[model samples]
Target: MNLENAQVQMRKGILEYCILHIISRGEVYASTMLEELTAAKIMVVEGTLYPLLTRLKNSGLLDYKWVESSSGPPRKYYILTESGRQFLSQLQTTWEELQFSVNEIVAKESKGE
Candidate 1:
């Protein structure tokens, strides 16, 4: 198995969760989101992000509003909907559980169990 492939798959699995968490904080623009993701080393391009944003909106998990920008055209700012908040809460719980489980297994293995 390719190590890089496995690492990429792992990152892909949590990308949406991370995105949701970011948007949940407050209304955010796509470019701002991209900068945050890049700063955190998630390294997503605009091509990947827009489609995911659309998918989340279509699924009723997110909504956006057009904001007039002084520099140029209006920008869409993403915000989490009620359903999105509930969904994110559940995902947070699952993330904690997975973290605990994985750490426990790794700890055991490291101890030569």
Candidate 2:
């Protein structure tokens, strides 16, 4: 098995949660989100991000507004809906639980348990 493949799968698994968390902070544009994700070493691209955004919107977890821009075409800014907020809250709890469980297991392994 390829370790690189596993690493990619791990990143993909949490991409949605990370994106939702970022949007929860405030309204954001795709480029801004992409930049932040890159800075965080998430290794995402526009092609991957756009489809995920559409899926989230279709699921009623997100909404977007098109704002006119003087530089060029209008930009779609994403904002979390009430349902999105509630969903994210649930994800937050799940993440914390998973984090604790993973840390405990890793700690045991490190001790040669």
Candidate 3:
């Protein structure tokens, strides 16, 4: 695959976790969340993010409130629900395990070469 395609594939694996971690930090508007993710070099569009947010909300992992915005009518700010915090904790554990496994494999491959 081409470099761009490969990068997109890589991001698909972790985007959900990344989004949860970001939203877990505090209540955040969609625009701000997009900015933060983009600044972190994760390419995401509203189309992608909104659907994921809706899914998370539907799953009872997130709660949101509408806040007045200077630029717009009102914007929805999302924060983690109690269940979301619990889920994030579990996700963190899983992420750590995956990171350790990947690091070990990479280190082994490097040492073998």
Candidate 4:
């Protein structure tokens, strides 16, 4: 099996959910968002994040406002919309269920079940 590809696919599957969780904390700048994701070893580039953020915004799951920066022209800060919050709650529930299932499988395998 292609282990590396599988790992990448697994990360990609949860990336959107992680991004939403991050934004649900508060309104955040794009650069800051990139930093948090990078620090978590989830995503690396503005290129990847920008498109996802735009898509989320377009879907009415997120909203943003341009905030003037002291060192830069302006930055778009994002926040979860009402719909976004609801969607995120659902994601959290699904994530918990999936995590539990995966852990159960791992435990069974480790025990040679």
Candidate 5:
């Protein structure tokens, strides 16, 4: 596959985790989230992000409030729930372990071990 297709394939698996981590950092509106993800070189459309946000909310991992904007209609700002913080903690541990293991494997292979 081409580089773009390959990148998309790789991002598909980790996008949800990355999104959650970003949201967990602070309350953010959908547009801001999209901007942040794009800046990080992770392209996510509203179609993808909205559904993921809905699922996270449904799972009680996210809470949102409608905040009135000065220029436009009210915007929904999402924040991590208590459960989300706990869940993210667990995910962080798992991610660290996976990263360590993958790094070890790559290092060994590179060394012809």
Candidate 6:
């Protein structure tokens, strides 16, 4: 199997969690979100981000409002909804548990046991 593909898939799997964390910090526009993700090495494109944003919006996990920009047309700034905040809290707990489990397994494997 392709290791690079696996790595990409792993990143994709955690994207929603990362996005929620970002939104939790504050309201964000798409370009800002893209820049943050790129800086974090997630390597996302608009094609990927827009659909995910739409899906989250439809699912009641995110909401947006248009803000006029001095440079051009209005921009949509996305923020997490109440439901989204609750869901993110749950995700955070799940992440902690999974991280602890994975670390334990990796430690054991590294010891050749």
| Steric clashes per prediction | 0, 0, 0, 0, 0, 0
Clash list (residue pairs), candidate 1: none
TM-score, model 4 to reference: 0.92
Residue-by-residue lDDT tens digits, candidate 1, 17-86 = 9999999999999999999989988878999999999999999999999999999999999999999999
The per-model lDDT (C-alpha) reads 0.94, 0.96, 0.92, 0.90, 0.90, 0.93
Q: Residue 21 deviation, candidate 5, in Å?
A: 1.3
Of 3 and 5, the candidate ranking higher by lDDT: 3
TM-score to true structure, per model: 0.94, 0.95, 0.91, 0.92, 0.89, 0.95
Global local distance difference test of model 3: 0.92
Q: Is candidate 1 or candidate 2 better by TM-score?
A: 2
Ranking by TM-score: 2, 6, 1, 4, 3, 5
Candidate 2 achieves a global lDDT of: 0.96
lDDT of 1: 0.94
Worst 10 residues of 5 by lDDT: 104-113
Off by more than 4 A, model 6: 109-113
Per-residue error for 108 in candidate 4, Å, reads: 0.8
Prediction 1 TM-score vs. true: 0.94
For candidate 4, the C-alpha RMSD (Å) to the true structure equals 1.6
- Candidate 2: tens digits of C-alpha lDDT, residues 1-113: 99989988999999999999999999999999999999998989999999999999999999999999999999999999999999999999999999999999877745546
Give the Å error, residue 20, model 5. 1.5
Per-residue lDDT of 17-75 in model 6, one digit per residue for the tens?
99889998888998898999999999799999999999999999999999999999999
lDDT of 3 at 32: 91
